[model samples]
Target: MIPPAALAIHLSIGQVYAFSVFNLPLSQIIGVTVSAPADWKLTTIGWIFSIAIVFLGLSAAVFGKWLERVGPRKAMFVAALCFSGGFFVSALGVHLHQIWIVYLGYGVLGGIGLGIGYISPVSTLIKWFPDRPGMATGMAIMGFGGGAMIGSPLAVALLDYFSSPISVGVSETFLVMGAIYFSLLMFGVVTVRIPPEGWKPENFVPSSKPGKLITSNHVDADTALKTPQFWLLWVILCVNVTAGIGVLGQASPMIQEMFEGVITAEAAAGFVGLLSLFNLIGRFFWSSLSDKIGRKTVYAIYFGLGLLMYALIPSLGRLDTAILFVIGFGIIMSMYGGGFATIPAYLRDLFGTYQVGAIHGRLLTAWSTAGILGPVLVNYIREIQINAGVDKAEAYTVTMYIMAGLLLIGLVCNYLVKEVDAKHQLFKEKKREGL
Candidate 1:
């Protein structure tokens, strides 16, 4: 029930990743007159998603402690309101043909919903299933990935139904999605509950590891920030996200350009959906594996194995084997999703559960940063090369190689991660003193 509540919230908020589905129609939306130039460009429209992501990081960082204090029910309710309201407001923005309004509505408001909603259920779930933290969180986070699977196609289908010669279809879709998400999230608010303080699941024996692989101590977000471990993990997340996001942001364009006539618009949408499915599956598969192999090893595979996979993508594209290319990227997408699901457990290992939610919130700043950097890098680099007369098929090669390099940096950061210092174990000391 708890996991499902979390999933209800996550599945709705996860629709943000599918925002790219609107990129084409939104950019070419017929405004005041069919003859008038488009009010927004692809680059300008890109900021809508970027701004929302920035707010997701910001709201999570700023309000994470508040979420802890208020608990999941209230937090999820607030998130539900803001997220659904953001869409309605954005719909108005579209009706009026005002980009700034859309930015304010969806980007800022919806983003706050995203951030709050994202972390709302994390800590509670961790507490409920201490013995299976990896699998527990993985189940909920998988919904985030799965949300995109549902959202991408759902948005496309809605657009087709609502769009006509007179309508661009974006505004109506926003209105509909907003209402649906609000209802689903409200259900989460109703269903979610916090366990009694100090409660542990029955038959679960706590690990008595000698070292810091698992800790009985807790660290607040502030102290966690003061440690080197947090920053290293932040770097790992940032670069890992950068590599995956670069591909996701440009999935449609990248595929069509690489394969041209071989890959149709429908096929590109299917490819995006395929990646989302893999993303959903990898969360459960990889994070559950972490229970046996440990979190650090899981991330090592994410970065090291990820590096080699990224390197293989460009060559696959050159070979013109669509199936092989999809398979390669599928592996990459799974690791991308795995990275998100595994990190909470990793945080538990390094920081303890005292303020793990807040710490996780602060750590999400890496995601906000990557959200902007990834798309900008891929799009900007490709644009420059195209202007230089590079072939469309070859434009992404440089981007792929750059992503591989970013993964290498992530590998280095992962290697540097160690347990937090004993000095930071204030909670452990407090427990000993019976304070």
Candidate 2:
């Protein structure tokens, strides 16, 4: 039941991933059928996504401690308000044809919803299933990965129902989506509950011996910032995210250009869909596996194998093997998603669950950093190579090599992670002293 509640929130907020569906329609809002002089440029519209991501990171880092203070119910309720309110505000902006209003609505207000909603259920799930933290977190986070699957189709359908001779129906679509998401999020708000103090599952005996990497002690989020392990994990997450996110943004274009005439736009879209499916499955599969194998080993596989997959994509393009190319990237995308799903449990293992949600929130700044870094690296480098006389098919070759280099750095970071120092366990002592 709690998992479903978490899913309701995650699946709704995950719609952020499918937001590209609105790009063309948004660009054509004034033109109705095509671009009009008054309509926004794609570049301008692109900033909406960037702003939302930036705010998501910022708000999460800022509000994480507050969420810990209030509990998931209140945090989720606020998330519902902000997220749904974002849609309502964006709808107004769309009707009025004001881009800045849309940015304020979806980018700022909605992103706050995203940040709070994203971390809301994570710590609760980790607490409820202490014996299997990775699997529990994976179950909920997997919904986030699969969210675009539901969101993209739903938005398109709504747009079709609402479109007309004069209207692209983006405003109408936003209104409907807002209502729907609010209802779904309220389910999470109503059902989410923290385990009673000192509660543990029946038959679950506490392990007297903690692993070297697994801490029985706690670290507050503020103090966790001062530890080396936190920064190391930050580097690991940023690099892994950077490697995958760059390719995700450019997946369709990259495949089309790599294969040229052999791959149709339709086939390229199918490729993107396939990658999304892999992303969804990998979120659950790898994280659940981590409960048995350990988080560090799973991340090691992500970076180690990721480096090989990225390095090979260029050659697959040169060899003109579309199937192998898709396979290679499918594997890469899975690891990308797996990296996200597994990290919360990794944090729990290192920092303990005392403020794991807040700590998790702080770590998402790495995602914010990667969101900007990944696209810039891929998009800018490709532009540079093209301007320097590189062929369309080969432009990504250099980019892939650079992505592989990032994975190498991530691998080193993952290997470097040992355990949090006991001195940082001062928070545990404070708890005993009733501080």
Candidate 3:
């Protein structure tokens, strides 16, 4: 029931990933079929998504402790309002042809919803399934990955239904989607529950001896910042995300450019959908696997295998093998999604469940950094290559190598992670004081 509740919120907020579907329509809002001289540039429109991501990180960090204190239900209620209201506001912006209104609505207000909704279920899910935190968090976060799968097609269908000679249908689409998402989120708010005091799964006992990296001691969110382990995990997440997000943003374009007429735009869209499917699957698969194999070991595989795949992508393009290229990227995207799902449990392991959600929220600032860094690295490097006389097909070659280098840095950071120092443990101090 809780998983379903979490899914309802995640699947709706996860629509952010499918926002590119709106880029073309929104760009042509005034022209209906093409860009008008007064219409927004694609580059300018790109900032909408960037602003939303930035705010997602900011709000998550800002509101995380509040969520922990107030509990997920109230937090989720607020998320539903902000998220749904953002859509309504953005719809008005579309209707009035006001870009700043759209930014204020979706980018700032809706992004607040995204952040709160994202972390709302994390601590609750962790508490509910203490014995298998990895699998529990994975189940809910997987919905976030799957949301784009549903959101993309749903938006396209709405646009087709509402499009007219005088309208691109974007404003109507925003209104409709807002209503739908709000209904979905309300279900989550009603269904989600926190565990009873001192609750544990039936017959599940605490481990007499925790694993070397697993802690029975708890660390508060503020103290987590002073620990090396937290920063290491932050680097690991940032690097992994930076490598994948850039490519995801460019997936449709990259496939077309790499295959050069061999793959049509329609085919490229299917490829993106396929990557989304893999992303959804990987979130569940890798994170659940982390339960058995240990979080640190699983992340090592992500960075290592990801490095190999990134290095191989350019070669696949050069070989003119679209299938192989798809396979490589599919695997990489899966690891990318897996990285997101696994990190919460990794935090639980190192910091204990005490304020883990808040810690996780603070950690997500890394994601905001990577969101800007990754796209810039990929887009700018590709442009530089092309301007320097490099062919379109090979323009991504240097970028791929650079991504592999980033993964290497991630691997080192993951290796540096160790048990949190004793001085940082809140429980240890309480015990020492005989509390």
Q: What overall lDDT goes with each candidate model? A: 0.88, 0.93, 0.92
Give the Å error, residue 6, model 3. 0.8
| Per-model C-alpha RMSD | 2.5, 1.2, 2.0
Local accuracy of candidate 3 as per-residue lDDT tens digits, 1-435: 998999899999999998989999998988889999888889888888988899999999999999988999999999999998899999999899999999999999999999999999999999999899999999899999988888899999999999999999999999999999999999999999999745799999988987899998889899999999999999999999999999998999999999997999999989989999999999999999999999999999999999999999988997756999999999999999999999999999999886888999999999999999999999999999999999998999999999999999999999889999988887755644633
TM-score ranking, best first: 2, 3, 1
Candidate 1 vs candidate 2: which has greater lDDT?
2
Candidate 1, residues 152-223, lDDT tens digits: the string is 888999999888887878899999999889999998999999887667899877766634477777777788
Give Cα distance to truth, residue 79, candidate 3, Å. 0.6
Which candidate achieves the best TM-score against the true structure? 2
Off by over 4 Å in 2: 427-429, 432-434
lDDT of 2 by residue, 260-313 (tens): 999999999999999999998899999999999899999999999999999888
Q: Give the higher-lDDT candidate: 2 or 3.
A: 2
Give the number of colliding residue pairs in candidate 2: 0
